[model samples]
Target: MESLANLECFVRSAETGSFSAAARLLALTPAAVSRNVAMLERNLGVRLFQRSTRKLSLTETGEHFLASIGGNLHALQAAIGAVTTERGEPAGVLRVSLSPSFGIGQILPLMPQWLARYPLIRPDWQFENRPVDLIAEGFDAAIGGGFALTPGVVSRTLAPAHLIAVASPAYLAGRPLPRQPEDLAGLDNIVLRASRTGRVRQTVLRNAAGLESAVQLNESMIFNDPVAMREAALLGLGVALLVVPDALPWLERGELVRLLPDWYVDLGVISLYYPSRTLMPAKTRAFIDFITEHFEREALARRFRAGPG
Candidate 1:
């Protein structure tokens, strides 16, 4: 029989394509992970991976082995998790991925309250802009919008990912506010270039009346990140399209004014994503419940909607 630790080391190393990355996730030294993997390989009597200074590639046998054992390992973990949950408090390193702007502005504020409820759980969160591979990257959960639904993962939508046009009050002063999407062409537009596509995004604004219009803007400034766009708009550089949560605070503070308030671009829903296991880790379940409860109690879905304002 193979040790579970050896199997874990092999699987994590394969997933991350590096021993150092596997070590980080397992909270073990790289040398320890390497030795465990070596032990597993010795037991199997086969070369599992082809190692190099720059990369690690799986052998054909290793690929077959990984595919065969992956689901079984997860099932075993689920069984263990079920027993562990029944015995004690929800506690562990809760690894999560979050979008930089939204996470800091909205979810970060709730951490103190959440920690009070589950003090045993240690938070390990990565603030990133791009969508992450939940299983491959060993993320327990991820909070963001525009993530593709991969196998074995499910999402719970927290709010609408609607983007509304905004401009600093200083920039809007003495300028005619946009009453329609087409009117935006006259203003200095701070636009986002899609990070994956490397192309400027075309804005199509829709109103409550189901009226939709393709917006033509001056495109005076371009950014690859929403956070940068928000900051540029705050500095009175130009009009920017921002998600409701990102712009809400500035709008409330009178620093930024919503342009074409009745119109917004719907990208998708901001969602909480986690692996769809038969029995989820207790820490992950607790964190998901905490966030969902907070969103429901605050009516954030309604507030994040940009249809009326």
Candidate 2:
């Protein structure tokens, strides 16, 4: 039988697409991860990956193998969790991955309460804009926007957020305010590089006639951070699109004016995602419940609602 260690190595390597990354996550060298995967392949009598200088692709046999064993692996983990829960208190390291903005706005504020409630459970947090591989990265949970939950991980919606376009009143004072979506084609824009996917930021704008046009923005003063972009927009640099939760305060204070009130992009729900709860560690379960309860409370929920424009 293949060893559990080798099986884990295979899964990690597959999920990360890099031997070096998987090695770092597992606290081992790349050569060690490669060896474990090789041993597993030998035991199974089939190659699992096609490797090149630039990329790693799974073999057909490897895909089938993963599909066949994935459920069993999760079940084994769940069994171990059940035993641990029955014995005593839950105490272990829980890793969480989240975007920097959400981390700053939501999760960080409530972390102290979580720490006080579960003093025995330690947490490792990583904040970034990139997509994370939960299983390969060894993360217990992640908070993020959008609905693109990867296969094998489960996701639960925590809240809803919308994207809005805004600019400073001084910037719009002399310039002809856009009456139609196409009018923005020639205007200066403050684009966020971190939020752009591929070559453009996909935006939908509504004209006075209530007609919506899908605009692909490729030109702008691009910034890597949202806060910086919003600051620049506040200084009359240009129009910018930001999430309602992040831009509402500026709008209420009259530092920024909503450019297009009738049109906005629905970024869908912000969610807390994790591996199956059947095998979830006690610390992770507690944190998830705490966050869910916090958002459900009337006072806290009101704080998230879009304020006066």
Candidate 3:
């Protein structure tokens, strides 16, 4: 068990590239994680990490050992979780990745109730707008849309991750509304720089009747996050494209109005993504089931429909 502890510390540190990051994931102090890995090095009579101020890199032995054991770590965790939760109650840290706009606006609100219901499971969620390498980064689950489902990972649809052009009433006080996708070429677009690629992503607009068109938007301002884009539109800076879920509140409050009521960018469904079902940890499984049920009960997916946009 002591060897197991050391291996866990070493593996997490390797995956995260630094002791501090591993500590956050493990819910331990950086010093404690560093000490554990050092102890393991002493026991094995070899340095596992080549440490420097900027980052931690794996030594040869560390790389070999990690390759040998990393694949089995989940199985070991699942076995322990099975015993710890033999009574059918899920317990353990449940780490998840989420985008801030939806995480803060929608999911965060339901967390109190979720925590109450699953008192044993600890939520360690990361709020970010970029795509995450779930298996490599050791995230239990992630939420978003348009991510390619790699082998050994799976997803469950939550709601449409559709995008539509919007502008504040003040911004469009006298401006002609865009009646078609191509009309958007004439409006000033607040665009998003893709987090993963560092490029402006192409927007494909779809109509209610399923017709599609691409737009080469005229950029007025550019943002890296959806929240910022939403704010720009709200401030009457320019027309911005936003996901339905993120823009729902503003639409309801009449702070922003959707343009081209029939056109939307089908970015695909936002989903709860996780590792394979086989050998899944109890905490993750519990979260998946809980979130699914919550969505159904609240009819949350329908709310993302947001009256055409």
Candidate 4:
């Protein structure tokens, strides 16, 4: 039988599309990954990859080989997990990636409880506004909002993300409140542009008269950070479309007010995403369960229901 180490290297290289990338992910050298793949190919008596100066492509044999072993490999991983769970407490490094704002406002504050509960687990956390390549980056899990997930990762919703249009009371004080969405054309709008795709600035609004219209505003300020957008809106720079959780403190403090509350967009759901559970490390599984339980039992649930305390 081919060594499991060689099989693992081959599978990782195929999934990531490069020997160097697979090596980095596996904490092995490029030569080591290449040697393992070559060894596996020799053992199987078939070429696994078409090597080139520029790129790598799987051979027909390699494709069939992967299909044949994938299910068995997943089952083997699951069996290992079942054995480990039945034995004792989980232990290992749990690597996590999350969006900056949510990481700061939501997850970080609650981490102390998680740490206390799982003394055997150590966590390595990264925060960014961009999506993480979980397998490539060696992260066990990611917390994110917006954007469709890449294939090969599993995702579960943690909360519903509600985007609201908000501006400071001073900005709207004596001005005719945008009774209809079309009236926003005359208002200054703040745009959050985290991704290159830019932010959505159009909104649909219904007036008290039950008349509905679409409003598209020209942005007066474009910011990549949600916190900065909130500050600009507070300074009366313009109106902003903000996620409710991030805007809650300002709204409660009377620094900002929601506009067109009835008509707003639903950004992608907030989720806790991870690689397939079958290969998940014990520490990762524990962290996932902890986060899931904490959100349900803590202030997060209430905040989502009653609009940020």
Better of 1 and 2 by lDDT: 1
How many clashes in candidate 4?
0
lDDT of 1 by residue, 1-309 (tens): 554557877999999999999888776667767888888898889999999999988999999999998768876665545433345778778889999999999999998998898888899999988998775556789999878776557999998999999999899889988877999999999998987899999889898998889877799999988999999999999999999999998899999999887889998899999966656778888889999999999999999999864
Q: Please list the residue runs of candidate 2 whose C-alpha ends up more than 4 Å from where it truly belongs after superposition.
A: 1-90, 146-148, 174-177, 194-197, 206-211, 216-218, 298-309
Model 1 spans with C-alpha error above 4 angstroms: 1-79, 83-87
How well does each candidate superpose onto the true structure, as a TM-score? Answer: 0.77, 0.66, 0.73, 0.69
Per-residue lDDT tens digits for candidate 3, residues 1-309, read 333446677899999998889877765567767887988888788998998888799989899989998999977765754534557778778789998998888889889888897888889999988777665456788987766676456889988777878899999998988777888888889999998889998988877666789899998788999899999898999999998878888898999998988778877788999866445667777788888898899787877763354
lDDT per residue (tens digit) for residues 1-309 in model 4: 454446777888888999999887766667767887887887778999999998988999889988887667756555444333344777666789988887898789877888787766677889888887665455778998653465446888877676677899889988877754666678998876756566554565443344556666787887888888888899988888777788888888988988765555555478898866435566778888988987888656456532322
Question: lDDT per model, in order?
Answer: 0.86, 0.72, 0.81, 0.74
- Greater lDDT among 2 and 4 belongs to 4
TM-score of 2: 0.66
What would the C-alpha RMSD of candidate 3 be, to one decimal place? 8.2
Residue clash pairs of candidate 3: none
Best prediction by TM-score:
1
Which of the two, 1 or 3, has more lDDT?
Answer: 1
